[model samples]
Target: MCFEKCARCIGIALIPLAVLSVVADILLYFPNGETKYAEKDQLTTLVWFFEGIVGAGILMILPIVVFIGLKDNDCCGCCGNQDCGKSCAMLASVLVALIGMAGAGYCFIVSALGLSQGPYCLTELGWQYPFNSTNGRYLTNYTSWSECTEPKHVVTWNTTLFSILLVVSGVEIILCFVQLISGLVGGIVESCCHCQEIVRCNDIEVNVYEVQE
Candidate 1:
């Protein structure tokens, strides 16, 4: 039951994080709230990969649903036995949590790469990644951000949204890992308890038969 409570809490927490990731990824397409950059294909290539939209947002839905469902004891009505059903549900939750972790991990990696490579924007020379070769040093060096002349503060916009995705994905990964552990332990414990119940029932039946004889 504690595991179920934890799963429910995690599920609720993931909802807002997923929504935030999707919003951040969408924002990357339009720098400075202008669609001109997107029309000119000046957005970062990493944004096109949809790590935040697909990986962190959509991919997390299934796991969230599963985790939320874990809170309801009556929902696990498999094989005409509540204990067996609960065991099955907990094991299934472990698998769902793994899927969630994979999605969040993908988003985290892509966000990091996006931040390191910097955003694609138009400069005096033309559109390109101005800080691509900076090896992420530009993050701390405010002077380098001026390299991207167009899209007005694109460097700042990209950094803000990408940073948000990075942090949100990291938290998601941690929550999923915690849920995975909880589900695995809960499953094992429920299975052991279910087995003991069967043994006890069988012993009672045998003793009754012997007394009747």
Candidate 2:
């Protein structure tokens, strides 16, 4: 029951994280509040991957639903046994948590790569990756961000949004792993309790028969 509560809390927490990931990914397409770069196909390639949207956002929905549903008392009514039904639900939750973790991991990886590679923007020469050669040193060197003359501070935009995705996705992965462990523990505990209840019932039935005899 405690683990079920934990799962519900985790599910609630994931909602905001998923929304933030989608919002951040959407913002990546428009640098400095301008859409011209996206229109001209000058946005960073990583944005096109939809890592935040598909990986961290949509992919997490199923797990969230399962986790939240764990709180329902009659979720397993179709199984005809409450304890057995709960065990099945917990097992399902464990599997769904793995899927959520995978999605968050994908988003985290892509966000890191996007940060390291820097954004694609227009410079004096032409449209290209000016900071790609700097080995991510451009992140700390504020003066170097001036290289991307177009998109009006694209480096900062990419850095902010990608960093957000990185942190958010990392948290999501951790939460998913926690849910997975909790689900496993809950299922095992429920099964053990169910077995003990069955044993008690059988013992009671035998005692009554012996007294009647």
Candidate 3:
């Protein structure tokens, strides 16, 4: 009963996948910031590049997953202990919470990182550099829509979006964790109380029998 109530069957496969999805989503939230620094440091750029790529992946698939989850769940999602629990609701809750956390955590990290460097200055990446700088400052005016519109992260945009997403995601994650833990604890407490009551009843029966004898 505990196992059934605690975890869902449908989610066994989706949880880890959702984690990857979220990681990707957060990475892409600010692509401009990522590419700007890639020009200076290969290693940092690599990390940033991966982050952006992952974020993009999440953006692509998250909506589909959410739609499916919504259709399967009740309003409270995985909050249901019995009827709803067996449904898609509980699984959805867990997924949503985890995804939300991933986005939120990234936002928090980016905002904190911003203190060290000002908003990602595309100029620093030499895109804004002088004379015939085709990639940065001039690329927008020159390149085709593909090059011009493709993900070019802006630090300012990344910072702002990340910060907001983080706070919101962070809060939701906390609530989800709290709700989950509390439910478990409540079950434990109820079980213990039942056991104690059974022991008390047994003791009383023994005492009465001994007195009669």
Candidate 4:
């Protein structure tokens, strides 16, 4: 438990994460539809690859965990069980922070490194693709977005709120991670050294064990 008796602090730490998500939600105003494509360069592949990994790690994984925290762990003081409540509260807080940070990091990576793509172009199906480089050479050959001017999958934001959210979420997550490092590491080491100790773990207790008669 990184924070004892302060689930609120953990929750507060996620404020930046939530703020970034909210900011991303409102990022359609300015429009980043560049008409031109970027020129093919050494950095393009690396940028796109990093962007993909970051995207999956953040967007796909974070929201699900955070939602769990928001919905499940309300910190019921009425339980009157100190140990149970404390563990539950800490778990919820850590889950939320981890998920939020992952999401925020994805957004940041997308913003900074960006993804591989070209300008929009009409296809045989008649539906236009947002990033079709072969048709118009948007990203791999153009210098300015204007050369490939077209709507894209992700929106752009003028305000720096997203960056701010990323920073805030990163800090909170780092703190929470630090808190977990010692305890979780100790548990893992002990369990690895002696499997019987693992049997007692609340998180990994065997629901069913079979032995030949």
Candidate 5:
């Protein structure tokens, strides 16, 4: 009973984590044009975009797996000594969770590395500059910048967006680990509970026959 409750709680927790990740992934597409950054970063922006798509897809599916695991647990009682369904569900959920965790971890790594290199990229792309003589002691208009309409603004937005993605990925990785452990441990405990239930039912049936005799 406790295990089931815990599984449900874990499932509920994964919902928001997954949603936040997907939303952030979608938002990552904007803030900086894909084509523009794809050129300089050796397609790092494209990589990030694809990673977002994959992360969002995995996260979206994660909730469904959790729900299925919960459903399997609820159905355990009805299945009555037959742990096939529940076992299969647990295994499937665990597999999905592992895959999701891997994806989330990859995203976290990429986003974090991007954060480290993003400032340099901004400078290289003319989004920002040093305190050099040309840029300093003199005011410059937006027209002076190339590659982006408003280079400074775009870079700021990009930096903020990447930071958000990094945080979201980190949280998701942690959540996925939690869910993974819950599913594995819960599956084992649930199996033990089902075995006890089966034995108890058999004993009750034997007692009933003796009473009838």
Candidate 6:
């Protein structure tokens, strides 16, 4: 029930989504290995990198679906006959979109949680673990969050990358859902219309034969 134009438009829109996720992942690379045990262990950067790849891969389905649809020039003419290629293509697209949605959704949730948790650290001030402050005098063999440099604890790069990952993947999830629905509904509608046309044609042929007899 959806026209080629509609599918094409959706496919075109998918390009940007893929690009955005890819870009976010590229940015995530900078902070991925920066997790130092002496500080907090922020896995946001690592998670973002992998999820961005998954999200980008999912977005690729739209373009492939569009390409297949375009290549099947006889789809409309052979409407009455089932075109396995078209059906398969649509099914494949739907499956890919579903996978993409799951991946993006996961990344979104993990990133959100990581953001809230503010990284994992046994103690906020590991750097100051060697010293303790008592009676206005600094003593050795003590560690506390109070002694750590506040600014050093903040992983600026990871925070920014994770924020970007969270936003881009969220957008991708919505797009994947839309793509799945459109492909499924459109393919079914087209198949039904083809069947109806074939029946109508058959009825016309039968009536003509009876009149001739």
Give the whole-model CA lDDT for all candidates, comma-separated.
0.92, 0.91, 0.41, 0.39, 0.57, 0.55
lDDT of 1 by residue, 102-174 (tens): 9999999999999999988888789889899999999999998898888889999999999999999999999
Order of the predicted models by TM-score, top scorer first: 2, 1, 5, 6, 3, 4
- Candidate 3 TM-score, C-alpha based: 0.38
Worst 10 residues of 6 by lDDT: 132-141
lDDT, residue 149, candidate 2? 87
- lDDT per residue for candidate 6 within 75-114, as digits (tens), equals 4444454554455555556776677677778768765554
Clashes of 5: 0
lDDT of 3 by residue, 94-191 (tens): 45545544643454454334322322333433333122232323323333222222234343344344444344434434543543443355445544
User: Which regions of candidate 3 fall more than 4 Å away from where they truly are?
Assistant: 1-107, 114-121, 124-153, 180-188, 207-212
Which pairs clash in the backbone of model 6? 129-143
> Higher lDDT: candidate 3 or 5?
5
The sequence of per-residue lDDT tens digits that candidate 4 reaches over residues 115-173 is 23322332344334344334434334434443322333221222233344345445544
True-structure RMSD, every candidate = 1.4, 1.3, 11.5, 12.7, 7.0, 8.6
TM-score, each model? Answer: 0.95, 0.96, 0.38, 0.37, 0.65, 0.64
Clashes of each: 0, 0, 15, 22, 0, 1
**Candidates sorted by lDDT, best first:** 1, 2, 5, 6, 3, 4
* Superposition error at 207 for model 2 (Å): 1.1
Model 5 accuracy (lDDT, Cα): 0.57
Q: What lDDT tens digits, residue by residue, belong to model 2 across residues 1-213?
A: 888899999999999999999999999998877877788888988899999999999999998888887878445553699887787788778899999999999999999999999989888889999888888888999998998888887888899999999999999999999999998988898889989999999999999999999
In candidate 1, list every pair of residues with a backbone clash.
Answer: none
lDDT tens digits, residues 1-213, model 5? Answer: 454455566667666666776666665554455545444553224345555556644654665466436654544544554465565555456776677777777777766655444423334445443322242221233342333343335545544655666676676667667667776876787677778888999999999999999
